[model samples]
Structures are given as C-alpha cells and as structure tokens.
Target: MSNEQVVNLNTKNKKINNRQLVKLSIFFTSVIAIMLIFLTNVYIVKEGEYKVVRQFGEVVRIDDQPGLKVKIPFIQSTTTLPKVKMTYDVTEEEINTKDKKRIIIDNYSVWQITDPKLMITNVRSVTGAESKMEEYIYSVVRSELGSLEYKEIVNDEKSSRGSLNEQVTLKVNELLQKNSIGITVLDVRMKRTDLPSENEQAVYTRMISERESKAQEYLSKGDASKNRIIAETDREVTELLAQAKADASVIRAEGEAEAASIYNQSFSKDPNFYSLYRTLESYKKTINDETVIMIPSTSSFAKYLQGNN
Candidate 1:
C-alpha cells in the first residue's frame, strides 16, 4: 500500500474502535441501571409487619407474609405497618365524677391493626390511628368515669375500676369498629388517678375530717354502752344490798324470838333467882360514874338498892 492509503486506513480503523467503545459503555450503563432498578424495587416483609403497596398514592396491595416482596419501580411504593400489638400512652385529662368531684386521670391502651388496608383508608397512618384512638379513649373514659364516684374510681378496696376499664375499652372498640378505623383496642387502663393540684389539699382535709367524725361516732357509741353497763350494775348492786338487809332483819327477828322464849322458860324455872338477877341487871344499867337518881323507899326498884328485897 502507498503512504496515503495507509494513513486513511489507520484513521478509519481508529474511528471504528471509538464507535465500538461508546456502544459497549452504553450497554454496561443500561445493565447497571436495570440492576439498580430491580434491587431498589424489592423489599422485605417481616413477620409482624404489613407491607402496603400503593400505586399513584392509592393502596393497591398488602403483603403480610414474611418474605421478599416486589413492586413496580417508579410506579408503586411500599410502606410498612406493624401487625403486632402497640401501646399508646393517652394524655392525662381531668374529669368530673358522679359525686361531683373532679379528678385527673392518666391512661394507656394496647391496640393492634386488624386490617391495614382499612386502617390506611380510614386513618391513613399509625400516628393518625393513634390520634383517633386517643379521642375515643378519652371520650369513653370520661363518660364511664363520669358515672362513678371518686371513691369508686380511686379507692382500690372499694373500686369499680375493673368494670370501668372494661366499659371504656368496649365502648372505644365499638366506636372504632363502627367507624371502620381498622384497629382494635385490647385493653384500656387507668395508669394513675389524682386530684387536681388545686383540689388535693381540700380533699385531704375533708378525708381527715371524715375519719375524725367516724372516730367520734364510735367513741360516742362506746360511751353510751359504758353508761348502760354502769347503770345496770348499779341497779343490780342496789337490789343485792336490799335483799341482804332484808335477810339480816328476818334472821335477827328469829334470834330475838328464840332468846325471849329461852328467857321466859328460865324465869319460870327459878322465879325468885330470876327476879333478883333482873333487879341487879337493872341496877347495873342505871348506874354510872356520874349517876344521880332518886327513888321512893317503899318502891320495888328501891328495894334492891337498899338491900331490903
């Protein structure tokens, strides 16, 4: 080949090589992009979650099974939602009780998504569902608690709290079901109960007063019982004393009668000796250290003193 032919051939070969390199680069770039699209379009569905696939911002399918899931790239998108139980701490609120008392109630609830499609359609998101749940919870709780007294709600020993919680939970579930909210409340519980800060002191004072009044009432009853017992005892003592005195009087009369009979018999057995003894006994009774007496000499009383009997 001549020099001109050689130069043209070299330039043409170089152009062909450049064209092939451009084609190859384009092919590899397309392959890499395709692979990236396929990988990015795939997702994992966990056991406790639901992967919702939406087309054009609308839900088209839901994958709840635990495995690899795919959606059309750039056309469909997937969002995950928990299928397991979730807890929501409800905001504390103040409510009036049946007894016209106000109390602050803090509550919590356990909930689950029964149908993610329905949930997404109605509530749109977990946060939205929780917000709605909270509304129902507060409403039901308020209504239920409003029918109960403060003591029934707060005092554990006298509480109707279990029934209250059940009523609230049931009512909340009913509302959610009625509205097709796609969630169910398994339980609703009152975490804490307290008097409002402004009312606590007043309630405490009133409680103390009530306890003191009760104590006073018991003391009054005890005093009345004690008095009744004392009165009964006094009556019994008086009766016993009177009976004892009557018995002593009867015995004394019997003794006196027996003594009189004995004295009469003794006098009859020895009339002269008995007369002398009686006279001497009378003399001793009438005489004393300062004794002053006057008697007729002819009288029988003077006869003993004069030794003339």
Candidate 2:
C-alpha cells in the first residue's frame, strides 16, 4: 500500500475507536442515572403507617401495605400517616352547663387513622386531621356539657356522675363521623372536670365542711345509741335489785313465822322448862361487863356475883 492510503486507514481506525468509547461512556452514564432515579423514587411503608401518594400536589394513590414501594420519580411524593393508635390532648376551656354554671374541662382522645383514602380526601394531612379533630371535639364537648349540670360533671362520686365519660365518647364519635375526619375514636376521657381556679378553693372548703357535718352527725348518733343502751341496762339492774329485795323479805318473814310456831308448840308441851329457858335468856341479856346492878336479893346477875340467892 502507498504512504497516504496507510495514513488514512490509521486515522479512520482511530475515529472508529473514539466513537465506540463515547457510546460506551454514554450507555454506562444512562444506566447509572436510571439506577439513581429508581433508588431515589423508592420508599418504605412501616408496620404502623399508611402512605399517601401525591402527584404534583394532588393525591393519586394510597399505599396501605407495609414494605418497599416506588412512585413516579421527581413527579410524585409520599406522605406517611400513623396507623397505630394516637392520642390528642384537648385544650382546657371554660364551658357552660345546663345549670348555667361555668366549669373548666380538660380532656384527651384516643384515635387511629382507619382509611387512608378517606383521610387524604377529607383531612388531607395528619396535622389537618388533628386541627379538625380539636375543633370537632371542642364543639361536641361544649354541646354535651351544655346539656348537663355542673354538678354532674364535677361529681366526686362515680356512680352519681352517671356515665359521663361514656356520654362524651359517644358524642365525640358522632361528631367526628359527621365531619368526615376519617379517624376512629377509640376513647374520650376527661382529665379533669373542675370549677374555675377562682372557685376551686371555695368548692373544696364547702366539701370539707359537708364531710365534717356528716361526721358530726354520725358521732351524735353513736353517742345517743350509747346513752340509750346504758339507760336500758340501768333500768334492768334496778328492777332486778328490787325483785331480789322483795324476795328476801318474804323468805325471812316465812322463816320467822315457822320458827315461832314450832317454838310455841314445844313450849306448850313443857311449861316449867320454857319458864327456865326464858329466865336464863333474860339473865344473859341483862348481864354484861358494863352492867350496874342494885343488889339486895333482886337481880340474878348480883346473885351470881355474890355466890348466893
């Protein structure tokens, strides 16, 4: 071959190799870009989350399943909402009841996102749901409380309060359903139902006074009962003692009468011995160490002392 032809061939081969290298570099770059887009577009739906897929600010789909998921790259976005139970603490506010008394109510709610599609359509965002829930719950609580007396709300006795928490739960659920908040209200509880700060101390004092009054009443009743028991016991003892005294008198009289009858019968049988016994008893009665007797053949005690009769 000629020198010029050989040079042209070498130049053509170099251009072909350059084109192949450029194409190879472009192919690899395109693959890397596609892989990056796929990686970036992927998202995970955790066990307790529901993801809402939005395309250009509009909700297009909902991913309820938990695992890896992919969406349109750079065009769609995903927002995850908690599917587990959540709680919202409602703010404390003064509410009027049927009795025309104002009270402060602090409440909380347990809820969960049940339907992702409905949540997106109605609430749009979790924060939006929370705000809407707060409004709805406040309205429900106000309305329900407005129909009850302040005494019912603040009763310390649970039975006397008459299922207040259940009423609140039912009312809140109804209101949430009406507003389409797409949340299931598991429970609604009252943290506190109390009088305002300015009135609380007065109410407490009144309660204390009432409790003390009741205690005093019980004490008085106990004392009265004790007195009645003591009086009855004293009456029984007096009656028993009087009966015993009467019985003793009757028994002594009967014994003395029987003894007199027996002695009369014995003395009538032996007159001389009865006289001797009477004389001896008289002498025994008349003689003692303090006795002063005039002698001169009179007193038996003088005869015995003088050893003559």
Candidate 3:
C-alpha cells in the first residue's frame, strides 16, 4: 500500500477500535446499572423483621413473611421494623392518689407491633411507639391510682394480688385502642412505689404515731378487763363466805334448841335425880387438880357425889 493509503487504513482501524471500546464500555456500564437496579429493587424480609414498601410517602406493600421480596426500582422504597417484642422503661413519675397522697412510680412495658402499616401511620418508628406507649402508661397510671386511696394502694391486705397493677394494664390496653399504631401491650409492671423524699419522714412519723396509739388503746382495754374480772371474783368470794357463815349459824341454833329441849325433858322426868345431877355437875366444873374443894364436899354436892339418898 502507498503511504497515504496506509495512513488512511490506520486511521480507520483506530476509529473501529475506539467504537468497539465505546460499545464495550456501554455494555459494562449497562450491566452495572442493571445490577444496581436489581440490588435496589430486591429485599429480604428476615425472620424477625417486617418490611414496608412505600411510594411517594404512602405504604404500597408489606412483607411480614420471612423470604425474598422484590419491588419496583426508583419508584418505591423499603423499610423494615422489628417483629420481635420490645421493652421500654417508662421514666419515674409522681402521681397523687385519691386521698391526695403523692407517690413516685417507675415501671416498664412489653409491647409488639401487630400491624406495621398502622405502626408506620401512627407511630412511624419503634421510638415513636415507645413514646406513645409512655404517654398511655402515664395517663392510665394517673387515672387508676387516683381512683384508689393511698392506703388502698399501699396496703397489702387490700388486693394482695396486685390488682392495682392489673387495673392499670387493662385500662392502658383499652385506652391504647384509640391509638392507630396497632400495638398490643403484653404487660405493664411497676418497678417500685416510693414516697417522695419530702413526704417520707412525715408519713413514717404518722404511721408510727397511729401504731403507738393502737397499742396504748389495746393496753387500756386489757387493764379494764383485768380490773372487772378481779372485782367480779372478789364479789363472788364475799357472797360465798357470807352464805357459808349463815348456813353454819342456822345449824348451830338448831342443835342448841334440840339440846335444850332434851335437857328440859330429862329434868321434868326426874326432879330429884335432876337436882343431884346438877349438884354433881357444878362440883366437877368448879374443881380442878390444883383447886381446894373442901367447901364443895361439905355441901349438897358431897351427898350427890357419894350417890347418897
């Protein structure tokens, strides 16, 4: 080939090579674009995730079932929410009971998003859900506790089964029904109920005073019962002693009367014998081992003592 011809051929070859390179580059770029498109449009709903596909800020698809998922590229976006149960600690808050007693309460709640679409529309996120739930919790607690007396809430004997906690839980669930988030509260628990630091000392002092008053009242009642019992026992003993003395006196009088009648009858039966017996009795009564009985022996008593006619 001549020089001009050879140069022209070289130029043509260069153009062909450049065109091929452009085509190849376009091919590779297209392949990359397709891959990118596929990657962006495709998604996976994991075991514990709820997938939501939104178009122009509106939910179009929800993939709660765990598997591979796909959607239109550049026209829709996906977001995933946790399908597992979640717990949120409600901050400590002070509330006044029906009796106007202030108590500090803190607690937590377990909840799950039953409907992701509703969750998105209402709460929009887990944090939002927690915030909403906290609000509900506070409202329910305030209402429920306010309906109860301070002693009723604090007293173990009243609703020993923690019915107050249950009441709050039920009321919370009911109130949350108005929430479009479709959240079901699995449980509501009380971390603790504490008296405000400012009220603690005063409440404790009042409780102590009440307990001491009850103790003193019981002691006084016991003393009064003891005094009454002692008085009753003393009266019974006095009556028993008097009755025994009266009975003894009656028997003694009856025996003396019987004895006197028997003596009078014996004297009436034998006057001489009675006189002699009386003289003998007098002599015996007047005499002792150390007594001188010379005058008594010389009198009629001597004759009666010798059994003389």
Q: Highest TM-score: which candidate? A: 2
Query: How close is every model to the real structure, measured as TM-score?
Result: 0.72, 0.80, 0.69
lDDT of 1 by residue, 14-69 (tens): 99999999999999999999999999999999999999999999999999999998
Q: Which order, best to worst by TM-score?
A: 2, 1, 3
Ten-residue stretch with the least lDDT total in model 2: 155-164
RMSD of 1: 6.1
Top lDDT prediction, candidate number: 1
Q: Indicate the TM-score of model 1.
A: 0.72
lDDT of 2 at 107: 86
Model 2 Cα shift for residue 127 (angstroms): 1.9
Off by over 4 Å in 3: 1-49, 53-58, 66-79, 159-161, 246-287, 298-309
Model 3, 253: alpha-carbon shift in Å? 6.2
Model 3 alpha-carbon miss at residue 268, Å: 12
Q: What is the C-alpha lDDT profile of model 2 across 1-309, one tens digit per residue?
A: 999999999999999999999999999999999999999999998898888899998889888888999999899998888889999998888898898887988988898888777767887778888888878778878887888777667667633334666776778778778777788778878787777888878878998999999999999999999999999999999999999999999999999999999999999999977866886798698878997867677665455557653
